[model samples]
Every structure is written in structure tokens, then in C-alpha cells.
Target: NSKINLAANELLFREGEAGQFAYLIERGRIAILRDSAGEYQLLSELGAGECLGEMALISHDPRMASAMALEDTTLTVITRDHLKERMARSDPLIRHLLQLTLKRYRQSLGQTFPDTSSTQDLDYLEDEQQAMQRMRTEHDLSHALDKQEFILHYQPIVRLADRITTGFEALLRWRRDDGQLVSPDLFIAVAEESQIIEKIGHWIIDEASQARTRLASAYNGKLSEDFYVSINLAARQFPDPELPGVVQEAIRRHGLLAQQLQMEVTESQILENREHAISVLHNLQSMGCRIALDDFGTGYSSLAYLNRLPVDALKIDKMFLDDMLSDQASRTIIAGMARLARDLQLSFIAEGAETEQQVEALSALGVEHVQGFFFGRPFALETKKEPA
Candidate 1:
């Protein structure tokens, strides 16, 4: 049985006081008050079914606001101890609701502006709000990221001249809790913004290397053991002083040869920090690891940096490969890039080659490697290899 009372006006808890009990309004109304300049200001109004003292109940901390009866209000009181005992045996749904309540409270505080402060306080509050939003995004992403939630999909790269499978790129896919497959573009940005890109990038390296090792083991008795796995590297992960050592450890753990794994770096990163990027590339190349400049022509002065960077390959951006037959400029660019790659003794890979015409154009351009939907969309690497 709960203690119920009908309280009148001036029946409120003092500011900075501790809360030992939570209250639920059963009748009339209640007002939540906060101290501003030594005066109480109404923060919110509560009616039937509305609960108060939640934060204090959860943290056992001092109450930041006071609850007072607006009129002759009937309230049911539940002691914090009782609430804790109930929470200890609460159902998952109830626990989730409490968590959501806490999240919403934090969000509200993040968005609220304090009126008693200067303009600087407003700017500070805005920054705090952004930080809080980022934290929430990270929390949600962390819940979504798990080994069981990730799946490896492979897309084949073909030799344009022979129209044969050269190798496959391991792509990450997530079949979300909602049973829908999430596109990389959707979650990749969130992961990057939350600083979780490093974890995801490392996971990709490990998964791709493991797949390559398994394939190698399977084809040990076969005539050809010439498949390669390319994994994209985030620019944020590059500056880590221990990155080279981490890559070496990953290779050893996965039983993969350093030459079999290619690290794909966006061309823009190379152009932005040429010196640092070159040093990193040199370190990787020293370890016998191959490096590919991804989205090659998309960057400014990309051709200029190509000579400076110790990259082994150039991945032609998909934008250039799209509508290759209809776009003569694109065809010319691809041809020039392919010729330059040949002259420089570098491998040229045309990405997103989706049509027969595109494949034919690339072959004619002497582009050796091509990857796109025309060859194969990304799929899980099962034990058996499907036809090229």
C-alpha cells in the first residue's frame, strides 16, 4: 500500500535538498521549480500519471529542482529504497523505459539555455549540446556494433582483358536488428564522427585477412594462389604511431602474408598531408605491404602526388567509371591515368565498372583491373567459390 496525501500550495521541497522518495500525481496538478537568482521559477507542470524525483531516485544525489503542489493535489509517494527494490527485480521493458527516461533528461539539459549567464554561456551551452548529441550518437552506435552483427561480403575484381576474376574486395555489411541491411554510406559517417572508425577499420582488416588466409589454405594444393584482399584505411587511424606495428600484429595473427593485404588510402588524405602520408606509406611499403591511392582522380593535384607517394596502385574513382561510353572526357581521363600507371610501373584499378560498354572501354584503354556490379556485387565468402 502507498501513502497518499492531498497537499496544498507552499508544499514544496527546498532547493539543494536530498530526495528520499518519488511522487506520482493522482489528482489536481503539481509544479516543478528551479532556483534562479534566489527565486523559484516554474520549470514544468505535472498532472495525472506524471512522476517526479526520478533523477534523485536513480543516483541518490541531491535534488536539482523542487516539486510543489499547484492546487490541492493528491500524490502517491514511493520511497527511493522501495523503488530500488522494485528496480532490482524489474522486467527488461521497465529497465529500458528507465534508461530512455534518463537519456531524455540528459538531452533536455543539453538543449536548455541558462538565462542568468552572459552571451558566452549561450555559446557554451550550444557547444555542450553538440557534445551531448555526439555522445548519444556514439552510445547508440556502440549498441549497434558487435561481431555477431557484422558480416563480410566480397565483390570480385576482374581482369579487363581476359574477363577473369583477379581477386575480391571484402566489404562490410550489417543486417541490423530491424532485419534490414544497412548501407555503408548510412553508418560509416556516424562511425567516423564518433571516433569508432578505428575500431571498425581494424575489424575490417582482421576479417579480410582471415578470409584471405582461409582461401590460401584451401588452395594450398591448387595450382594458383593469387588472390588479394584490399581494405580501406581511415585517415584518422594513420597518425597512430603504433599503426604499423598493429598491422604487422594483425597479419601475424591472421596468418596472412604482408604482400597479400592492400591498404587503400583516399587520395585526398595524401594531398592534404603529403609529408606525413608519404612517411606512413614508406613505412607500410617497407613491411612489404602494398598501398593503393583510392579515389585517385577525385583529389586536387592527385597526379602530382602520385610521383611523391610510395603507393603501389591507383584506384580510379567510381565517378569517372560511371557512364563511360557516354562520357568521352571520362574515357580520356581513364586512358591517361592507365597510361601513366603503366609508365610509372603501377597497377591501375577501375572501380564501379557496371556495364558491358564500361568494361569494354576499360579493356580497350589497357586498364588491367576492373571492379563493379557488372562482374559481381558483394557477397559473403562461402567455402565454395562461385563462377566468375
Candidate 2:
């Protein structure tokens, strides 16, 4: 369906026009023409399997040459979005090298075409040194998985009524070879953009599932009946139709009850691909796993969609707790969320309650559960006693 039919002698694109797509000749020939003064002259001819119009996509410039179908051509069109997405996922070293090559090509164009040098060229040259640093980081990330350098830290989610630890959210940390610990914020986006999140996400699910039993045992079986390990699902992983199967396998392999594994997702993640997201969530529910809406009230939190979702809990964002003491608006919003959660029969958890007073205020606002440093910070399983 992405294939297009072009008539013989058809102009695909003209020089001086913005390039929106690159085309692959699937079944015919294409002519590449360059304009000199006011007359267009043949520059090159391309046959089937050849690609054209891609330079502008990489260089962020107008088409340098025009393309026309030499015959009844069938071409596969690659959109700018597709190219840009792939470029974003490529290593910084490769991207920089590509830009450098393109820059030289542009410079050589001065003999025939107009000189196209600009500030963008200067910026690319300036960042040449930064490429090595970025390349090293990228190489480190590529090997981090094979080296088993990732670790999980659990933060207690405490029940307000009895002040007991009922569940813990599993947080990921990258431990570099040099003994440096990297936070998720530092490298998660990179992993997601590079498509490494899929592999890492599966590993997290497996680790958390295995940890659930050990955690309960560590607490001498005093952990509540609702004891669960909450694993944050990356947005990039949801599009995989096999995600539910992955979770099911994790729970089954670890001999865990599906309810003991909670999957946490943010609002924006759900909205980005609503149909697929809903399908994946429903499949998870069918396996008896629970779903929690994390970072609630921060993004795309629509009541209409919220009520329709197969969610079991609401985790209020930490920002609300940060401002709850000084801002009446924050408290009012927390109160409304608590009441909404209760009315909907969903569990309510307020995050980032650092002080007793904040916990008191959250408790007064009808929050049923809380998670923050006030109870216990995120502690590694190997370094610390089991979550209190």
C-alpha cells in the first residue's frame, strides 16, 4: 500500500522544493537532474533498487536535484518521519559521521551549485568533539545489558491505615563498570530512542517477578495480602503485541500469582496509541495482573478516558506533594483525587510524602496509601534490609 505508480516521464520532485520523502525504485528507472543557470541537465540515472531524494532529509535542506520517472515506475515511498525516527535511534557517532560526509558533499557543490554553507555547518563542526563522549555513552549502553549492569531498587508503598508496607515500586538503576550509578532519567530516554528499552523492559519484568517472592519471604510473611511489586512499563514497549505474553511468562516463571505483579503506566503513554494500549492493558487484565496509572494528574489525565480504562489504582504525582503544604490548590486537587479514587473503588497512593506533616495532610485528605522517603527510600535488594 505504500507503493505508488508513476507514469512515464513524470516529475517526482523538483530542485529548490522541500523534500518530504525518499523513494526507492521498485520496478523502473528514475532520472536525476540538476539545474544549471535556468536549464535542467541530466546528472545521473538510477535503476530498480536504487534510492533517491534522501539527502535533503539528512541535511535539512531543499532538494539539490530533481527526480523523474523514466518509465511506468513503481516506487516505495519512505516518509520523513520514518527516516528521522531511524536516525534518532542511530548511534551519535554514526550520525555525526554522516553529517560530516554530507557537509563535504555540500561544500563540493560550490563548483556547480550555489554555495550552501550556513550556521548549521558551524554548529555541527563545533559538536565534533562531543561526538566521542556521546559515542562512548552509546557503546556503554549497548554493552550494559550483556554485562548485567542493571539493578533494581524497591521503594515501599505503605498503607496509611496501618502504616504497613503492602507493595513496592521497582526502580531501575544502571551501574557502570567504573562504579558509577546512573539514574533512569540520565539514560532511559536514550535507550527508548535507540529501541533498547524493549530488551531492558523484559529484563525488568523478570527481575521484579522474581523479587516479589523474595521480598515477601524477607519480611517473614508479614507483608499484607495485597503485597505486589509495581513495575513501570516504558511507553516504547506497549506497541509490542507480545507484551502481555511477556508479562504472563514472567509471572509464571517466577511462580507468582498474577495479582502479585502490578504494571504501572503513565497517561501520555496510554494516549499515544490508544487502541493498541487498550488491547495490551485488557490482555494483561485477562491474565489477572493489575494496572496502575502512575504520575497521575501530571499529564493527559482525562476523567472520560480514566473511567473507561482497566485501571486498579491511581498514583498521585510527587509534584503535588511537594506543593501540598504551601499551596491550597495542590491540597484541593489531592482531596478531589482521593475522593475520585474512592468513588471509583480504585486504590489511591500519594507519592513523595517526605515529612510527617505531609503524610498527615495526605491522610486527612483521604489518601489510602503513600510512597515516599518518609516511609523508606528506594533501597537495593543486595545492599539494604528488605523494605520496612
For model 2, state the Cα shift of residue 153 in Å. Answer: 0.1
What lDDT does model 1 reach?
0.73
The local lDDT score (0 to 100) that residue 140 gets in candidate 1 is: 61
Clashing pairs in 1: none
lDDT of each: 0.73, 0.85
Report the lDDT tens digits of candidate 2 across residue range 1-388: 2989999999999987877788988999999998888888999999999988887667657787889888999999888677767766666667788877876787688634343434535544545676777666677888898898999999999999998888999999999999899999988877876678888898899889988877776653236876999999989999866677789899888899999999999999898888888788888988898899999888956687787898999998899899899999989999999999999999999999999999999999889999999988888775443433
Model 1, 290-355: lDDT tens per residue? 898888878677355467788898888789887678888878889999999999999889999888
Error of 1 at 125 (Å): 12
Model 2 CA RMSD to the hidden true structure, in angstroms: 6.4
Query: What RMSD, rounded to one decimal, does every model reach?
Result: 14.9, 6.4
Please report the candidate that would top lDDT against the real structure. Answer: 2
The lowest-lDDT stretch of 10 consecutive residues in candidate 1 is 112-121
Q: What residue runs in model 2 are displaced by over 4 Å at the alpha carbon?
A: 1-43, 46-98, 101-118, 121-135, 219-222, 383-388
